[model samples]
Target: MTHKIAILGASGYTGAELVRLIATHPEMEIVALAAERKAGMEMRDVFPHLRHLDLPTLVKIGEIDFSTVDLCFCALPHKTSQEVISALPADLKIVDLSADFRLRDPEAYETWYGNPHSAIEMQKEAVYGLTEFYRDQIKNARLVAGTGCNAATGQFALRPLIEADVIDLDEIIMDLKCGVSGAGRALKENLLHAELAEGYHAYAVGGTHRHLGEFDQEFSAIAGREVKIQFTPHLLPTNRGILATCYVKGDAQVIHKAFENAYADEPFIELLPLGQAPSTKHIRGSNFCHIGVVADRIEGRTIVVAALDNLTKGSSGQALQNANLMLGVEETTGLMLAPLFP
Candidate 1:
């Protein structure tokens, strides 16, 4: 029952993370690794931390025989993901960790990503991979689009509220903080140790961040109207996790009850006791999300905080969770590893 897996973009942060998780999966095996730039090198050579396991040498995407791969984890860059996935076998099951397939409308995709989607027909078939909310769809999907880490974190805090009509959709505000690794493993001057260390700053201010497209899509769909939250993301100095602090107009006790009821049967989503907040340190390197709710001093206002490993529950771990459903295997398999903490 082992699923033969191929990881495209194997040298990136999310790609290496897939390798780390799959190494321990009881029913999935990595049969190929593709990183066009890193072709002809061993995965361990590119990521020494992975030196402990035996894996295929990195190869260009064109060199792999997709016909043999039971499932593929497309961890490539956004535009690149659509281009590569468009040409793969039609029947190949895929979990895409890119923004490419996440938004359903090609026009909206172009509006946010600045280019027309290259694979329109494929977009039509792609299911949004917000595991908890779309479990049934994911189980039957051939292609699942993983959500942005920030989007995932925010939705965990607010989706239930929106669904229950317990919060005012008009006044939602999400101030999120994300670790640098969420930016990907690509080298950039801003991400340089000297520049990023000791200082924290916010980017994509004023509703320009692309993850807004996701928020717009999901929230609007849930509220049955155009729901846009004031979202501002700050870059953290560390290497993992996302903390989304959301402000909403709602009854505090009702908000807490809504979340507790919504996630009561879910495995990965944890609802903390009232007045207690979750920290990124608590969920590092684990496929778990901790959500906390607290009432503001002002009546009818609530603050919801959600924390998760940006690389794990935020990205790679999410991809694997959808892959499990698509493969008809236990959804929690190979993903119960505890969070790493000091």
Candidate 2:
């Protein structure tokens, strides 16, 4: 059965990535595209790369008929996602690519997001959309919240270690770097070509990045206690990809074994051989995440790294993965495309 899919905030990078992936999905069709600011323009006008496809014209969210859509991919901004999704039809399955519903606690949401969740009821029902960890839950969920690109990359490298009791939870440190596209299609002085093209710098230092809310939620849940990690993110000048290096107190062989055993047969997650690390370029434009493990100079410490395309596995591709499960279709369908390499 072909599912009718709608993308809200189609003018953004993540939305265009969704269109790029869904254009090849055998069981899904793009039926509606919404971009409030670019509402009257054709999708081709907003993204010339998508000019070849026969896609729906861009419209405001209010102009679309939700009843005909099987699922909706919400790629709107953080605070705006909650408002837009709150007004959507109740029966529609939603995959929100925003921070609006990621944190389970409403108080934490307000603290980090700077506003009370507008859709409290929906927030309560939204499933965290980390495809590997929450596969079963996502399959039956009505609303799925896609993770932050940085958070997803960090978790991929460390979740298994925490689960297997192989790492010191208190000492986990993640230093991540992401490309400019992860910043979205917004215009800012810092994101200008002249400013960002040849430099790299870290932001959200001192454990202040909002995606920490997700790291806190998932890690605490897995360890059955509070697990906080030191996280810092840097912006790179490239177009896409995230490389997260996680430092932990653990035995190298044990850490490798834990991740290898956990993702032995997973579709989108690939565990590289010991001492062989993964690069962001290897997973570009695909929904695959590659994780590697190596021993640190210290006897009882290990370094784990994970890489993936922030726009694909980190956002839109992840949204589609969850949507497939929610719709009872094969989880890996249309998502098995090989990563692009230089």
Return the TM-score for each candidate structure.
Answer: 0.99, 0.99
Q: Candidate 1: deviation at residue 124, Å?
A: 0.6
* Predicted candidate 1 versus true structure: per-residue lDDT over 1-342, tens digit per residue: 999999999999999999999999999999999999989999889999999999999999999999899999999998888989989999999999999999999999999999989999999999999999999999999999999999999999999999999998899999999999999998899999999999999999999999999999999999899998999999999999899999999998999999988999999999999989999999999999999999999999999999999999999999999999999999999999999977
TM accuracy, model 2: 0.99
What TM-score number comes out for model 1?
0.99
- Candidate 1 vs. truth: CA RMSD? 0.6
Lowest summed lDDT across 10 adjacent residues in model 2 is found at 115-124
lDDT of 1 at 30: 96
The lDDT per prediction is 0.95, 0.93
lDDT of 2 at 293: 90
Clashing pairs in 1: none
- Local accuracy of candidate 2 as per-residue lDDT tens digits, 1-342: 999999999999999999999999999999999999999999898999999999999999999999999999999998999888889998899999999999999999999989987888998899999999999999999999999999899988988888999988889889999999998898989999999888899999998889999999999999999999999999999999999999999999999999879999899999999988899989999999999998999999988999999999999999999999999999999899998868
Off by over 4 Å in 2: none
